[model samples]
Target: MSIILTVRRIDIEETLNTTPSVLPQIKMTAQLNEDRIWIDGCFDFVHHGHACAMLQARRTSNNKENSMLFCGVHNDAAIEYNKGTLPVMNAPERYAHARSIRWCSAVVEDAPYVTAPEWMDRFGCQYVIHGDDVTLDANGEDCYTIMRKMNRFKMVKRTYGVSTTDIIHRILTHNTLPSTDKDYFPTLDELEFCSKGVDGFSNHCYVFQDDLNNMLVRGGYDWDSTNSVLILGDFDLFHMGHIDQLKKIRNVLEPRRQIIIGVTSNESKEIIMTIKERVLSLLSCSFVDGVIIHPSKDTIENSSHDEKSKFSKVYNIDSPELVDGTVFSGYLTSRTIIARIETQRDMYVERNKRKGMPI
Candidate 1:
């Protein structure tokens, strides 16, 4: 048999200077070398918007010799300090992800416990670039002074500042809002009406602000342990996972504030729900003040039912009336409604329902 020969060619364009070397990973920075603009961040959740930010930075820097982006990984401690948790992806993983981008020139692991001052001093960075959405003065007054003095700092506008947290919340809400961490809040007053007048937007979502502090005005009825106000949303399929999220929020405001989670209605086209189970899910948490439902028909105007207890307010945000038209039938609802939830989690829930489960 004649021997068959096959040759495979591989092209390695740039250098892999920092990684797969040793322990105590290095702290590296992307510079405006003779030719390229370097973009750096934890880049934990690489996204479409992130890609755009990199592209814009590259164009702005106009590095002739380096036509690519440089990303820097912060040490584990750095990530925890800044983002309040450990990184979703580790160093080596982040390094490889950054390098995979066609625009990226290199990826390196940053040293642990290194401050920006130490980094600037070590890298002798000609210039440091970042996404516009990132806070320039995150460290403190001293950081501003350092960057100002070095004159090596640069920022590119972030076309999409959408964060990883936002993405996660959307996924959770859509797929696991009720089941993720379900908690029930009792209501001071509960009422049922098969009919509701379309409440037009009175823009009644009011936030209570004092001279020095801001607090939510909740009509606490059932919660005794935590004098706090309770706020829940479209808590479909109510599960312990959801309880985890609600309880965390409650713990801070607890004894001061607990939550009265509003279950989403499946009646209208405007409010999409999760699981789409014909049966309504029930919440069973002692900390929960009570559960309440929205009126199918109304006093469309967000008129306060003064005769009824004060706990009545909008429940589901997915309801069109909450964001749009209001009740005009000689009824008026308070412009200040307190159904607060973490903005990030709220976004997550909306995204989840659409993918399949329904929030």
Candidate 2:
């Protein structure tokens, strides 16, 4: 969905109380008496993934008189660890974004870190919402321990690719410095950008892709991804739109989902000139882990499936050596889109997609 720009920063308390453009809308505690929902976070960037979560929360509410909806944001220090630098968007910006989403009835600058069970007990939140992606932490403890405490919890599984970290990356890629030398080899971002049919555009941390053929091995991951999702296309002539799609997919894939983008490699050199490039184009992005050719006979497929899944995924892509406008308008590759739920997450693949781009 294309964004229709509106006001950047506005006071929620002020708008709801005095602005003629806005109306007085108080937290409907009575309406939500039996239904107390909490969205936990510092929500530093407050981008698309946040929006997705809010959308899901609202969906469950159904504008019902019986449901009461609320959201909470973490204080500055709490958010910093997840986001690098100065938490790109501040508390005011974060509140402004959350307020715009009507699903959220209240906003509080919560403490730095509070476990789910603790928070639920403190707020009496009848239902705590989480995305399907939440899982066991490094210590082997499930991330949703508190929510699991009671059946009142609700987990929303939405399409991926909308995330704050992703928004940061898009902002960074939009401002990538001019190419310089070997460093100029295609960027994982560039390959990922091309993979999704390039916009003329554009993470952190904390996830393990150990299964060998992660979400990148196949396809179909929806979320503002920390994990990468692979998209295959000829991508001969890159443009702004192509860039945007990659940003969208990267953000929408599973969290920390690195991308493994595949650019078409012509079978005959007579059709195109030789260009020196790296195995992966985008190396600078914190999100993309690596890149690769459309999958070769020697590549290792995941342990989950015995068939050459990696090669099979690449085989579905349809491409030609030619670079033209029609490719983006409508393009395909000779490879298949592949994803593995467990095998080495899609992130490395996302990073490596940039391997073949011309400087």
TM-score, each model? 0.39, 0.38
Highest-scoring model, lDDT = 2
Q: Per-residue lDDT for 264-297 in model 1, tens only?
A: 4444322212322111122213234433343223
Model 1 ranges off by over 4 Å: 1-13, 17-36, 63-68, 111-124, 134-145, 175-359
lDDT per prediction? 0.37, 0.38
Query: Using alpha carbons, what is the TM-score of model 1?
Result: 0.39
**Model 2 bad stretches (over 4 Å):** 1-34, 81-86, 121-123, 135-142, 175-359
> Per-residue lDDT tens digits of candidate 2, residues 166-213?
333333233322234443243344334322211111121111122233
